[model samples]
Target: MAKLTDMEELASKIIDKNVQSYMREALTCYMTGAYRATIVLSYIALFDDILAKLDVLAKVNKKAKKIYDEVSKKRGNQEVFESDLINQLSSNNLLTSLDSTFLDILRQLRNKAAHPSGHKPSAEEARFIYFESINRFLSKEILSTTQLADEILASTVNKNLFPSTDITTIAKVVRKELENIHPDTYPYLISKLIEKVPSSDGIVSKNTSFFITGLTFDNNDERIVSVVRRMLIEKKSQDEDYFTMIIRSITSNPIVLETVDDVTFKRLKVIIQERISEVDSTLEHSRFSHPVSMFSSMCGVLNDEVISNNFETEFSSAIEKFLYSSYLLNNLSKSEYAKEKYIEILMSKAGSSDFEVANKFARTCYTIIDELDVILTDQNAFKLIVNLLRAASWNAFGAKDLRNAKFQSMPAIRDKARALDLNDKSEAKKIYKEVFGTDTDYENLMGKYVR
Candidate 1:
């Protein structure tokens, strides 16, 4: 909206070399006091920029192709060609009505300036035409190619195109293609991709997710964040799978969390809590893994203080409940990668200074300490033993019975502990004696001590 002060400034905004040439000539004409010539040349530059954009869009868009074909046929007749192009652009939703109106005014000025008329545009009119032309059309990258979104959707099903299972690489390809699209087109593209989520098969669904997540890379545009937030709110209750996909996409790029409003964020917290609570160990691995992954990813986002603290307590409570849930403990023995991953997750929390969470985690581990080989080995096993003793020492009142039950149930746990190197073995024996008020019987460590 700022007024154009210098011709060089106006020319610098233009990207196309052809448009720059026209603007450069217009600047020269304006400097020589040729106001009418400036207005005419600037209009030419604006029209050429529009045509070039339409030509690019025509390759993939029927609307733009039709407009380009119609305008191409009318090229010889300047009056009809310009009028048809502007009216078509406006009607097709490419150019808003206001932009069309501004272009019309510039066209009128150009007509008057080009003709043998007494009317002469002043310097103000010339500069206005120059500035509006660049600001409205030339400098803007308005592809409006919604068809590109369709093509991308189709490409998602093609294995050759998305040959890599790596979501990052696939997302990079998606992001590269999306860079040519106007920001206004993103909402439509995003909605289309989300619409595909609930119904698509695994590969298609995953690729679609990668496509949506790809949009957040290197993009902090509020327009995109607003659209995604609105879609999330709309889809939260309407469709569970759709809601999950959108939320995962947002959390996939945690930076987006920085701009999310508190109300929306609270809703996300509730959804995540519900999902984690819904995790059923009785079901498939994905059922357990999906919610836990969501929980961990959302926790990662909370590291940034920009997110509201109002929901932190609620989220922490959810994390505690999830960490200590009977379902998670049951899942630890399931011979799947999710179990090991969740164990690592538990160990991470247990190793922290949070006594309550660590205690709950340690207590839950009591249910499955005999199944340690299913979840932990080597360093992880040693860490679990160390944490168990640490937690028991912190709350030794009733832990004595529970610890006795665990070691009694799984005497092999002592042999596993004794298998550690001299240093770790010495540390374990030290913590064990401090917690149980007895020395580890190195001669018969696996023997059940009923004290």
Candidate 2:
């Protein structure tokens, strides 16, 4: 519907000079009653715009550049033909379904007009080619590739431009363009996007979640870990979903735990310890779901041997403090398996030859005193006494004092074990004999306590 004057205004805005010239010639042919010429020339202008855009975008996209190179080679430095551009754009998602259909219609019209097999279009059809197809579709699509890149960047950084648009759609377009044109910006863009999540949760649209996850999947390494660290530190509140998302992504990712450096690992350990401590502080008032869930997820990272090895001392200290302070013993009383695991970790540390480690483990053992009725199995009671003895062997007290202390504690252990009926009296005798070896004083201690 645009007149020659209006068409010229549209033509002047095209960034590609060649495309502008072709557009003008096509418009001129249509106005001068040259219907067939207008159709052919309009198609030329549209095809040139597509090729020029593809060429600029391809500078950053290896795949797109590869296709462009092939098209150039086969066409011998001539412009890429309309059919080739349409097919490639359709496959690449640059053109939507309706866009492809319109392009197909133009291609068929161009073929009919150019090849000259008795298909002469009327003036009205020529008007449609020049004003509707060229002006509305092709020319409107022809922003300089740099302009296209800038527009995408603006949509991403400026929230108001595409207010209703899905952030993930914008991210997808940016990724596709970068995969072809600006591959180097992936890290920068990803970091910037992550920054958006904390300052304004709205910026991280639901659609954008997949984009964030996809970045981790493709680059699951130290850089991703660093991003997670910063995000966790920035998020001081107990946002369980945020914590859950990061922990699950990082844990399931292959290189995250393996490749994290010592400094970063230590930072992560401190953060998790702080979270667990927070939960411990509130154990009596709350039922321990939220922080417990967070801590449980973090245990996945701690379970890694390399991380665990580096964090042994700190880890032991946290477990000791948490168990000693919290009512976790009562909470875990119903879980036979958890009771076993807790005892194993505690007694293992208690068995250490190092006095400090043994003593720390011993203090943790004291917290379970009241819960011992249901918690101590026959096997654990044996292990518990063995651990206590091992710890006593490392006692800072002299060996003479250590001997006397062990002599004294054995009766109390026997009485407690027997009071609980933890082991058969014969089995208790067997263990006592193995350790005491027929000493008359030991035999008296055992005889007085065994019954």
TM-score to true structure, per model: 0.64, 0.34
Off by over 4 Å in 2: 3-5, 77-81, 132-451
- lDDT for model 2, please: 0.53
Error of 2 at 436 (Å): 91
Q: Which digits, one per residue and each the tens of the lDDT, describe model 1 over residues 216-277?
A: 64456778766766665444534567666755665555555655666666666676666656
Displacement of the residue 445 alpha carbon in candidate 1, Å: 13
List model 2 lDDT by residue over 65-95, tens digit each: 7667777676676654567866776676555
After superposition, candidate 1 runs with Cα above 4 Å error:
4-10, 76-80, 145-166, 169-173, 176-180, 191-211, 217-219, 233-242, 280-289, 295-302, 306-387, 390-451
